[model samples]
Target: MASNAQRRDVTRERILKAAARLLSEEGPSAVTTRRVAHEAGLQPPALYRLFQDKDDLLDATAEHVFAGHLANKLTTAPSDDPVEDLRAGWNLQIGFGLANPYVFGLLLDPARARDTPGQAKGLLILAERVHRIAAAGRLRVSEERAINLIHSAGIGTVHTLLALPPERSDPHLADAAFEAIARAVLTDEPAAPAQDPAAVIASFRSLLPDLPNLTEAEAALLDEWLQR
Candidate 1:
């Protein structure tokens, strides 16, 4: 015998799957309560019990999309070159936005946007990649700045590409955007003062924690310079 809770769980999954399909095929405007319920073969009232409102439903559907994206991102093993790994992540994110425009649109809505486990995990993955670059003395900017620059540039690239017609889209914009950001955040050589003075400071900052004979406060002061 199926318990009520188990039945509800199954029903919820069915509803979300239908909603996702609707969003993907028909576009964001088609994902209404009536349409979702019809696609799910459930009463509209039943959806109310699961999702508070339309915005809630949209957010959940976006989460469903991100869940899969995050899983795919995790399965790809990291490469030896952290910079290359970061570029790979950028490609993955750009692909996701282009492939799932409906989900991307819903997530862009300020009223519908909120933090999700999937987004948190994605940020953590980005941060780790940036950290690796910094640790390797290849980063000319702070890890946080580099991460933010990559994230902002990626968002802008996706938005700009999506706004144009398919035939009108510039296929090379993504590559160009990444290269521009790389120039701003990275150096050609690793930790060479002549090549990049800030990179040397950043490289030295990597050793701040391990330097012996420093008091806790002194170490704190030097670590603050890493932000530059």
Candidate 2:
């Protein structure tokens, strides 16, 4: 005989699979407690015993779906170039959202996203990728800011695509958005140019105020040279 815990696990799995099938075949409206319970070979009240309510079941379903997608993305081999890795991550996210619109909608809801463990995990994955760029000296902005910018752009892009009819959607919108974000947050070229005259002047100017060895008059003269 199966242990009680084992039976419960089997029941939960059945419920989840049933709910996911209904959601995929007939949309969210078809995934009611009654429908899922029937599909899972349980009574409607049994669903409440397993899940707190309909929303709880939905949340679990979304998390399960998103977890699979996140796993696939995480397993992908990262590119040696951090920028290229970021682009790959962006495409993966957009593709997942487009492929699973209902689950994506649930995960992408701003208010719900913070409360969802899967959604938070996804953001952390993106943040780690951004950190690599910062470490490579390719990021123009703070790591936190860059992460937020990329996250916001990705969410917006997915939502925009989801709102349109498939035929009416712009095929290049995702690539265009990513290029704009990359230009905004990444340096023009990799790892800052070697011996860039402007960068040298900027670096010198930053330390001018704190150079005790230089008198104010001398510092002023140095600043003038830096400008030239």
Candidate 3:
């Protein structure tokens, strides 16, 4: 017989794993209580015993996705240089996005976000981080402005990449594009000369590790400079 701790752990894992799988395949709508219970080898009645309801389950999944990310205990690596620290944080965010596109999608969905305070709170937390950095006068743009800029650009890039056919999509390319735009906007001016648009983009591509799935031609296309 499993200990109480072990039983609880097993149940939580079963729920989370089922939710993740359903979310990945069908977005949020696919994650009904019945579906999750089916996926987890639990009866619908048993699933209710585990969670309050479908909304509660969805809330838990949202929280699980953002746990280490935008929560109160945000994961910012210490850096003597503030600019570098901010850049690293941004990279970490992009990494999170790549690692969990489904959760990322849910977080960005306006309809679902309205129903989940956890997702809204996560954004507020991220905004506060930007606010703090801006208050130090260390940013090129105001904190709120900076956050809006980055947030809009990041969401746009992700959405566009996701919409493309798999043959046309390259996550590495998307990452590179975001990095370039981020560097252009975030780099301090006095220490750095005017950013060369081409150089900013090149820097983005340079940061990408080699990808196994990307074809030479597709990779080349992804690497091409953005049009004016």
Best-performing candidate as measured by TM-score: 1
lDDT of each: 0.87, 0.81, 0.64
Clashes of each: 0, 0, 0
Best prediction by lDDT? 1
Clashing pairs in 1: none
User: Which wins on TM-score, candidate 1 or candidate 2?
Assistant: 1
Deviation of model 3 at 118, angstroms: 4.3
Ranking by lDDT: 1, 2, 3
Model 2 residue runs over 4 Å out of place are 110-114, 192-228
Give the per-residue lDDT digits (tens) of candidate 2, residues 1-228.
Answer: 999999989999999999988876787788899999999999998889889988788889888888878888888887889789999999999998888888877666666664667888898999878877765667766566688999999989999998999789899999999999998887765444463434334444545677899989999998778666
Put down candidate 1 lDDT per residue, 30-147, tens digits, no spaces: 8899999999999999999999988788899899888889999999998899899989999999999999988887777777667888778888999888877877778888777888
Lowest lDDT 10-residue stretch of candidate 2: 195-204
Clash pairs for candidate 3:
none
Error of 2 at 62 (Å): 0.9
Tell me each candidate's TM-score: 0.87, 0.79, 0.59
Which residue ranges in model 1 land beyond 4 Å of their true spot? 1-6, 193-195, 204-221
lDDT by residue for model 3 (1-228), tens? 999888877887788788877876777898898889889998788677678988778767766767745653465545555555555655666667766777887677776665456556656755655544443334454444566777777677667766789788775765576567556555443222254443344334433336568788876677553221
